[model samples]
Target: MKRISAVIVNWNDKETLARCIRSLQQQTHGDIEIIVSDNASSDGSQAMVKEQFHETFLIENPDNLGFGTAVNRGFERASGDYLIFLNNDLEFAPDSFAILVDALESVPGIGAVIPKILYSQKQNAINSLGVNIHCTGIAYPRMLDEPDCDDLAPEEVACGGIFMMRREVYEELGGFDEDLFLYHEDHDLSWRIRLAGWRLLTNPRAVFHHRYHFNKGKMKYYHSEKNRLHLLLKYLELKSLVLLAPPLLLVELAQWAHSLMHGWFFLKLKSYGDLLDLLPRILVKRRRLQSRRAVADREIARLFSSDLQISGVQSLALDFFLNPLLKAYWLWIRRYL
Candidate 1:
């Protein structure tokens, strides 16, 4: 039996971390190791873990390293053949780890697996079954707030908040891009995984309950918008990028207009500014990734979903008009890819 390690990243969310730890401890898989990577949380979470769950390996960082970095740090000390990266605010079903591990081992080419995630407050409703990306680089959670279903197919991106991957896969991929820090880290990593010809599957037999609520946070907007553009520049082949330029520009305009109305115009502008600053470094990394890509851009483009599934933010024009147009555009340009 392959041992599994759960690396839970936390920052000031002590109570939620406790619940997450308890759930992990309840896993039916006895060889599972629990690793708590605290990001310099001031909420006395370190002491709580040391006193209450001292058996669990704990890494108390001196400063608040970002989410991906902290998880990577915890993983450095992990001793299991399989690794589960997770947020602090989640509860795993008793058999979740078992189900995920079984799926990973049973599949031949799968690189990672994420369980169906349901909303903690509304357990009957689905939170995510991993993430999906649009051709324009927009990534959103699949099945957000929708009724739970048993569609256990493969996905474009594993939900970064919680998922299991083999130790070799994690190490080979070089772990999460620390620059992503919070948002879209999963999309970036999963995209690379797909580019390397590894399929990602979501196993319905396992479930994770997440305490998630959507809010229009400024910092959230910052990283999400910036990292998305970064992905476009880094992953998409130049030919594909040129072909998609018009729609991409239109999306930017729409975002600018939407941001102006919603009090986030500066953030929209700032994301572009930040993208410019990071361009040279990003393109260098792009060359590295592009050279390693085993899958063609056109083949990979098929993984992108046509439907737009942004959560919590609603707009009449967006819902009724823009989405269909974008879908049409994707359908048309995708043939070219």
Candidate 2:
């Protein structure tokens, strides 16, 4: 049996980290090593891991170094055939690791496998199955709140968080981009993985529960908006970027308008404000990313779905006037339309 190394990055969430560790201990896959990389968390996270789960490896960093950097630090210490990047706020089903491993091994071309993730609060709801990109370089969770089942089947995509990767692929393509402080790092990694001629899959047989802290507010919105723009500037081909420019600009304008109307003017301001502050850095990163482009424009184009569209008015109005009806409409669209 191939050994699997599980790397969980934690920062101040001791309770969630404990639950995650318990789930790791219960994994059916016995040939596994667990590593907890704590980013100088002041909330006793390091102490709790050291005192409670001494058998598991722990890396206590001297200071907070952001998510991607901490994961890269953990990857250096891992010694397994496969590496599993798990969130601290997640708990896996007993066979989660085994099932993901089985799927990746069965499909020789697959570089990464993501398990079906359901929301812990809403038992029947999903967190994410896989991730997909639209033509404009916007990416979203494929199946966000659907029931967990084997119905989706195995499919390929750009990437999925809470996924496992072969050790060889990790070494070849390199680990997570450290510059990405938080959001869009997984998407960036997935895009690179696909460009390197490896596939990503989602295995429904493996299950996990996620605590979707929907009320995270502005911090979430900031990272999401900033990293999204950074990703487009980094990997998207110039031709595709030009084609997507109009819709992208429209989306940004709509977002700013909505934020202003909803009393989130500061939130909108910070997103663009940060974008300007980071523009020089973004340009430097973009140059580096373009230099390493092994995959052609056509190959990258195949990863996106042309049918996806983002209408500003419809999206903004639906949240205010008809959420339930809109939910039903989406269900119908996803089911039959």
Candidate 3:
């Protein structure tokens, strides 16, 4: 049997981490090595892992190195054929790892597999099957906060928090983009994986429970907006950009309007400023990624979803006004790709 290394990056969330560790210990797949990569958490998370889950490997960083970097640290130490990147705020079903591994191994050219994630408290509500990115570079889980829809198909991106990937593929792709730090890292990595001619799958047989919560803070909005724009600037082909320019501009306008209305105008402006400052460096990375792309821009374009799914109270103005326009614009431009 192939060994599986599960890495969980955590910061100041010890109680949930303990629950996550317990679930991993109960996995049916016995050759699993669990590693807890703590980001200098001050909540005694490191001590809990050291004492309570003594069998699990623990990496205590000197400071908070962010999610992607800390996970990379765990990836370097991993000796398994497959790697499972999981969030500390989750509980895996006994066969979750087994199911994901089986799906990945059975498929040709599949680099990763994500399980159906349901809310820990609301079992009937789906957290995510996987992830998808909109044409405007908004990454989201379609089933987030929605009742189970039974839509179990392959996805454009794997959910960031919990997914399994082949070790060799991950290494070849250089793992997650650390610059993203928190948000859209999965979308960016999965986009690269697809560009490298590897398919991603969603396995319904596998299951996990997430204690998911949507953050409304300025930092959350800032990283999301900034990284999304960064993703587009880096990977979106110039031709596609030319064709989609009008809609993209409109999306930006709408974003600005929404932010202003919601009192996040300054944060939104900060994201744009940061994006401008990082443009040159992002372009360099773009050249590197584009040079390595095994697929055409059009092929990558197909993976993006037409609709953007946001998890929060639905805005009547957005639903009745903005979304229809956005959907129509996407459908029109997608054919060109």
Candidate 4:
């Protein structure tokens, strides 16, 4: 029986956090320890954890640090053979951990695995299956909004962060990149794990319900685009980066057009400016990861899709023109990668 350390990152989600922790306790797998990583919640979440969940480990952050940072704090204190990083707004099934532990051990090459995430608001819809990778540095859940199927089996993915992994893989990858602060840290770390010759998968047998929302506003665009570039620098070798330069630039132009239409043009510019400023540090990390990685760029290129689709956002040019052009370009450039 492998012991699993579950780390739940919370910020002002006091009620949901308590429900999530209760769900973890009710798991059929009894060898799991829970850690609550509260990001300075003002809603009395820390106090509730300390008073009610006395057995659970609590890391009360001083301020509202981002998701990755909170999870890292929990990871530092976790003491189990396997680790599960999660959000506060989730509820696990009775045997979720047991099923996930079996899945992780079932494959020798799998570094991490995510469960079939179902939307709490929807009766029978799936929130995420396997996260898909795009050529234009985008990552999205492939089976989003699909009806749940009982026979759905496990599948490989570009990356999965609401995930469970062997403790050794956690030590090797050193968890999520704190520099990303909020978004795309999963993609950044996922690429590193893949480059290190480890695979990520989704086990549909284990189910977790999430309070998934579709928010296309706020700092989403800024953090997502900025961190997407951050990972691209750290993983792609020089030759691959140069070859990918054309499509990358074209994506930037299309991004600008979309931002302007959405009234977030200035925010997009700010993301670019931050990327420019962070270039020096990004390159340093890039060199370190590139030196130690076991896989080549070409191997990973095959995992990237050519389409750039965002749910709810529609554009005539994007669907008919940019998608096809990117698809063709990726087909040609990947051979040289």
TM-score for each candidate, following the candidate numbering: 0.96, 0.86, 0.95, 0.96
Residue by residue across 112-182, what tens digits does model 3's lDDT show?
A: 88788999888588888788677788777856767765556655453343678899889999988888888
Over 174-227, each residue of candidate 2 has an lDDT whose tens digit, in order, gives 798877788878888888887777888888888888887754465666677777
**Candidate 2 — what's its lDDT?**
0.78
Better of 2 and 3 by TM-score: 3
How well does candidate 1 score on lDDT at residue 116? 89
Q: How close is each model in CA RMSD to the real structure?
A: 1.6, 5.2, 1.8, 1.3
lDDT of each: 0.84, 0.78, 0.83, 0.86
Candidates sorted on TM-score, descending: 4, 1, 3, 2
- Please provide, for model 1 over 242-325, each residue's C-alpha lDDT reduced to its tens digit, 9 standing for 90 to 100: 999987887787778877887888888888888898888898989999899899888888768888756556888888988999
On lDDT, the candidate that comes out on top is 4
Off by over 4 Å in 4: none
Of 1 and 4, which scores higher on lDDT?
Answer: 4
Clashing pairs in 4: none
Please give the lDDT score at residue 152 for candidate 1. 55
Off by over 4 Å in 3: 149-161
